[model samples]
Target: MTGGSTHEIRPLRFGVVAPITTDMPAWRDQLRGLADSGFSTVLMPDVPQWQPAPGPALAVAATITGLRVGTWVYASPVRPAWITAWEAHSLSVLTEGRFEMGIGTGRPGIADQLRELGLPLPPEGQRWSQVRDVVAALRELDGPDRHTPVAMAVRGPKAQALAAELADTVTFVMPQIETRAATVQRVESFDNRRGAELALHVPVVGDSVAAFMAGPDTDPAAVRAADSLAFLPSDPAAAAEEIQRRREEIGFSYFVFGADAAGALAPVVAELAGR
Candidate 1:
């Protein structure tokens, strides 16, 4: 299956995040353009960053015919589980199963953003507690039939364990210290425990990729390590080659790109869409 489709072997799939601007019409066009460019879906990040909120942006995606929308991850620590459940449920319905919800313990700097919003920034335990709670809430509402596919953005042992137990997908958030052998080991660890799909979320920094899109504070050395490329070549042919190599190496078949990388990434999406 490609991009979490029912197919067994992970298919090569590419996706882009929502653009960093809030022009509604332009956002619509950007998503449409990505769909036209062969991207399987468009995912949005949940942060106080330049991107729009996943709900509204996903609503925009609903208007477009072919594109799918997802939250790269909703910051669970700052936001309550029930609220996220409701939003994700509503979005899944509105989009007719064309939505995917990515959940994660809030990223760095999210505490600062939460502080500004007066949202409670709990300790790691409380934050981690909510991840399963939210998933349970969604499942209680719809069961497997209506529950939206959730991709957990996880790095640590606790978070990864939670993902294997509860999430429909586990997107391993490669750390700055990430390496090929380490990635392989992590993947192996998730292999038996997770009942759902496996995905890798990483930054792409290289020629043709804009800095804004390469992932937050991306390390060039990390990108080049052990041929585990969450960040890869920007050239269409070269990018395609890189993807094929990595898929063979560690089976990273699904990819998510940042907004700034869209222009540089569309070609890669087009080149190796189904192969």
Candidate 2:
């Protein structure tokens, strides 16, 4: 279930994770930088403060930047299915059809925030059910009239199956386990029966990056470096080798780099370009 075409040497398609900040100018600048750096896609997740609203910033991002823009995992419980569908459609149209929407159950922190905002919270099981329904609603849109393909970020069996059944792609953040073999098996086990293509979301870290500074409590720097290196090759040829190796091992062909800024993005982009 690969997203788009996987016939190229690098079966993995590269994209950057958008910085979720309220500063619209900074966000647009980051998008421009990513476009200039040769990123083909960008993942804009639903952050509490940096909620995705179809506005001028997104409009400019679509108009000025050539990179494909989409959400990593937009929270489904935050809005009605129709509203989410409408916003996604608008962005897709605004971007001239370079948008994709990834829906998922709200994370714990996001759930808490939504609760504070007085939004109703569904049970965990029902949340996944809603995820499927949301994707179905988006799929109902007419061709060319729809802005983006809908995908889901999932971890468990139930969620993975939902993604497989409804979404065009399935994205996974690197799990706590250390080995690529484990990662591959985990994704395969969850995704084997399902048909959605897999996309692995790997973070790219550098000095002064937010994730680097504020990740889990155990040697933050080392964890940050390790996470960044997961998608990177030890050498130039190694990238292609790793891509093929992971694809054969795990069945995933899409790679998304969740980076901090321009500086952190350059090295990864350069390495992928060499591949």
Candidate 3:
């Protein structure tokens, strides 16, 4: 129901990338800024160094604004599925149903940290198995009492198949242009004739449009057309257009916006909202 018919509608939900910083004030300000900018959701990464405990931030965001808050990718191996399940349910209840859980194989760096914590990194195949099992457990928690959907952030072939089988949504963090196209292609391949919804996590660089354009593979023509943003065009709009172009070419619709920093998201949000 949310995405409409698979072919006719473009899934374009805009959200802020989270963990604005370790500074609590900065984090809160980022949330406030995103809410002010008309963003309805935020994606908090589960990087140990940056992710604050979900308690205070989730509570405050619920109290202050109607922003939907959830982790971008909670490391599946770092915590047991039950504990993650409990925390997710608690937040869902606390936020009055604005919580969504994103789970993935913990990052390689995170695996090293797990070693420091005296935990063994499960072998790669086992890790995916664990993610699948964990997702299954979360899905079982989806009765009327706990209705939040679990989204999976997947990269490789195995994980992609698991995502198609288990997740309500599949997400990808696209750091480069080719990766973006590849992500759409992979999703299309998985969904087959039935188009799938994809949530793309994109980084926002600056206050101006030019900052977004400052990245590699920028198109000059896109810079001319993206004047909606006041700051010099960094070419985020161009980047977004490229992504959309790829999606159309590959026959997939649905995207979620994520900014590297909280402030970096303003131009992107403006552009998406047709400002």
Candidate 2, residue 177: CA error in Å?
4.3
The TM-score leader among the candidates is 1
lDDT of each: 0.72, 0.61, 0.59
Task: Give per-residue CA lDDT, model 1, range 167-192, as digits (tens).
Answer: 87677777645666777777766643
Model 2 is weakest, by summed lDDT over 10 consecutive residues, at 1-10
Best candidate per lDDT, number?
A: 1
Clashing residue pairs in candidate 2 (N, C-alpha, C atoms within 3 angstroms): 1-197, 92-147
Worst 10-residue lDDT window for candidate 1 reads 1-10
Name the runs in model 1 displaced over 4 angstroms: 1-8, 20-22, 191-195, 208-228
Ranking of models by lDDT = 1, 2, 3
Candidate 2 is scored at a TM of 0.77
Residue 179, model 3, lDDT: 39
lDDT of 3 by residue, 104-187 (tens): 886546667887778788777887887777666665666556677678877777887777666766765333334333444555
- In the predicted model 3, the residue pairs found to clash are 209-232, 209-233, 209-234, 210-232, 210-233, 210-234, 211-234, 212-234, 213-234, 213-235
